[model samples]
Target: MNSFLTSGLIHAAFWVVVGLTFGGAVLAVFPRKIVYNVLGLIVCLSGVAGLFLYLGSFFLALMQLLIYVGAICVAIVFAIMLSPPLHLEVPKRRMGKVVLSAGASGVFFVAIAAVIWKTVWHPAAERGADWSIVTIGHLLLTRYDLVFELISLVLLVAIIGAILTTGFSRRLSS
Candidate 1:
């Protein structure tokens, strides 16, 4: 009885997380205000992190929350706050442009979906049973040093760019 109840609860939680993810995605894209958009992105990323947890990849979930929800979303919010046009409304777009963009996106989506469906995904024949966090970290630092350094550089540049823009705006205003 207890096992059944636990399973049922887990299923319910999974649906809730999925709903939050899609709802947040809709909220992120549909909002006209920058603040709302940022908030929605945070919510969506949080939902994605929760979904990752459900998939049994605890490390990935933690990274998703840390890198995407915590770091990137906070940085985006900071950038929006630093900008002077917080109160300015977004300009309306023409219907033709909107339709063209939607059509292009649809085509891209279809092509990607076709590729995904056509691809034959096979797991590696030799599987290592060791899944320790420490090992993962060591591998990242040793084998993927260049990729890690690149990611860090990109993040640093983004932060610097945000700071420069804010400083420039402040100087102009003064």
Candidate 2:
């Protein structure tokens, strides 16, 4: 009975996290306010971290929280703060553009669904028991070094761009 209850609780929690993730994504995209978008992104990232925790990857969960939610979101918020307040009226979206975007999205969704339907997913024959932080760190530094460095570079460039843009906007406003 206890095991069944625990399983039921875990299942419910998983769905809740999924719901949070989807809701946050919608909130992030649909809102006109940048602040609300950032808040939604934070919520979405937090939900992803929770999903990672449920997957038994504590290290991944921590990294998701620390890097994405902690660093990126804070940086975005800072960028918004440094920029001048946007008081310009938003232009109305054209119906043609909306239809085009919707059609493109539909095509992409169909393609992805077809791929998923055709793919045969097989579980690993032998699962590795070494999910330790040290193993992951070593793998990241050794095997995935280039990818890791590229990600770092991208983040650095983004931060620099944000600062430069803010500076230029301030100068222009002055």
Candidate 3:
């Protein structure tokens, strides 16, 4: 009974996270206000982090929150605040552009769907029973080498941008 209940709860949580991710994505795209967009992005990122948690990757979930939600979203908020014209009027989007965007999105979706459908997914023949931190670290450093390097690069850029922005603000104030 306890196992069943736990399984049910996990399934429910997974759906909830998926809902949050899609809902936030919609909110982010459809909002006219910049602040609303940023907030929606944060929500979306948080949802993605939740999804990572649901996938049994605590490390990925933590990284998603730390790098995307913690750093990127916060930086965007700061940038928005620092910049003038918070309430700048947005120009009305043209019908032609909207139609073009929609068409492109549809094509991309179809292409991606086709690729996914065509691809044969194979799980590892011998699945490792061991789920250790050391194993994860080794895999990340070895197999996912490029991804780790890219993440580091992104972090470096964010730090540099923050430093430059702070110095520029101080100079402007003085």
Candidate 4:
């Protein structure tokens, strides 16, 4: 057997990470406590960062840590703090709704899997092999200029909106 994938250490690490990610999802979405859910989301996102590292995208993995773990998760934490207690029990889902949701997600997953498996992925006919950060930046500015600009604009708008909303709410309440 190949030692890398089948080794005891590797297997242990893989299973642990999988368990953490799955468990985190359960924690984040389930339970009445919003705090626990947020904690779970953080754990889940960290696991995703680990997965990104394993997938040979160290840059993406670091970015995942910096952005998702740092910014989005922090924002969620702040939101939760602004809200009520986490100990409240949310209403249980109806069986039919649960089944429908499961069915919908399952179908979507299967459809995506089928499309991925059936499709043939080919690089451009005469693609240049440039995977450097500089190359990516260049591509972003030239080929994906609009998308790049749009994302920055969106983030800026979101920040301004968040500030405006919070300021307005405080004034109105006062």
Candidate 5:
């Protein structure tokens, strides 16, 4: 009975995360307000991190929270706060442009769906059984250290650039 209850809870949690992911994606794209879009992105990233946890990848989940939610989202929020607000009216969408974009998106979606449906997604033949956090950390620090450090450096530069740009804009306005 306990096991059944636990399984049921896990199943429900998975669906909830999935819903959050999809809902957030829609919210992010469809909203005209920049703040709402950022909030939606945060929610979506959080759902992705939760999904990583469900996949038994604690490191991935933690990294997702740290890198995307913690750093990137905070940076974006800072940018929004520092930048001047635009009171420009929303432009009316052109029907022809909208139709073209929609058709392109539909074609891309169909192509992707077909690829996914046709793919034989078997497990790797030599899949390592020992995928513990310790092993992963060791490998990351040893083999992928440069790539990891570069990513961090890039993020740092981006954040710095956003701050500088906003500061310069404020100065120009003043």
Candidate 6:
């Protein structure tokens, strides 16, 4: 493929992924219903998986989909089902509290945006040309292997605890 067409295709893909990610984030934060907010989180996570793909990390993208959208979201769904009935309409907070929260979040956003915009990100002098999953696996296993094992252990414990908690709750309820 020609350089021009290839560059244009990459650019197009980047923008499409960016739009999906930010749009999903907007929906997640702005929605009134908790269910909609959860769905939005799932959508946003999927977009992040797309970004991982664009960054040439297919394994990370798959992990993001599996961990965030699949396991975490399904766990959240289960928790919601196990919880007491939700109010049909969420009660509004006090006007002052709402204003305070909004103002705090807006200020935080501005601060973060200003820092990011002002900081000039200089790329590494010599970036690696190899962006393969095999390299990632080898690197992680050789240099930073402990973290990988720890993460798996933590996930196993969390799954076991979730099951126990849900099971105990059911027995108590009965």
The model with the greatest lDDT is 5
Name the better of 2 and 6 by lDDT.
2
Q: Can you tell me which runs of candidate 1 are displaced by over 4 Å? A: 86-138, 141-161
Candidate 3 on 1-174: residue-level lDDT in tens?
999999999999999999999988988899899899998999999999999888788888887898799878887887777654435443457899899999999999999999999998766545644557657767877989899889878877876786686666556554
Off by over 4 Å in 2: 86-134, 138-174
Pairs in clash, predicted candidate 1: none
lDDT (CA) per prediction = 0.84, 0.86, 0.83, 0.77, 0.87, 0.81
The sequence of per-residue lDDT tens digits that candidate 4 reaches over residues 41-98 is 9999888887876666777777678678877887777665554334644445589989
How large is the C-alpha RMSD of every model relative to the true structure? 10.5, 10.9, 11.4, 12.1, 11.1, 11.9
Q: Residues 53-118, candidate 1: write the lDDT tens digits.
A: 999978789889978987798888878777776555444577998999999999999999999999
Could you tell me which residue pairs clash in candidate 5? none
Any idea how many clashes model 6 has? 0
Q: Write the per-residue lDDT of candidate 6 for residues 1-174, one digit (tens) a residue.
A: 699999999999988998989888988899898788888888889999999999998888988997799878877866666564444333445899789999999999999999999998866545744647777767777877898778767876876787787676556555
Cα lDDT of model 5 by residue, 113-155, tens digit: 9999999886645674566787777777898999989988888
Model 1 lDDT, full chain set: 0.84
TM-score of each: 0.61, 0.56, 0.54, 0.53, 0.60, 0.53
Question: Is 3 or 6 the stronger prediction by TM-score?
Answer: 3
Q: Please list all clashing residue pairs in model 6, or write none if there are none.
A: none
Superposition TM-score, candidate 2 onto the true structure: 0.56
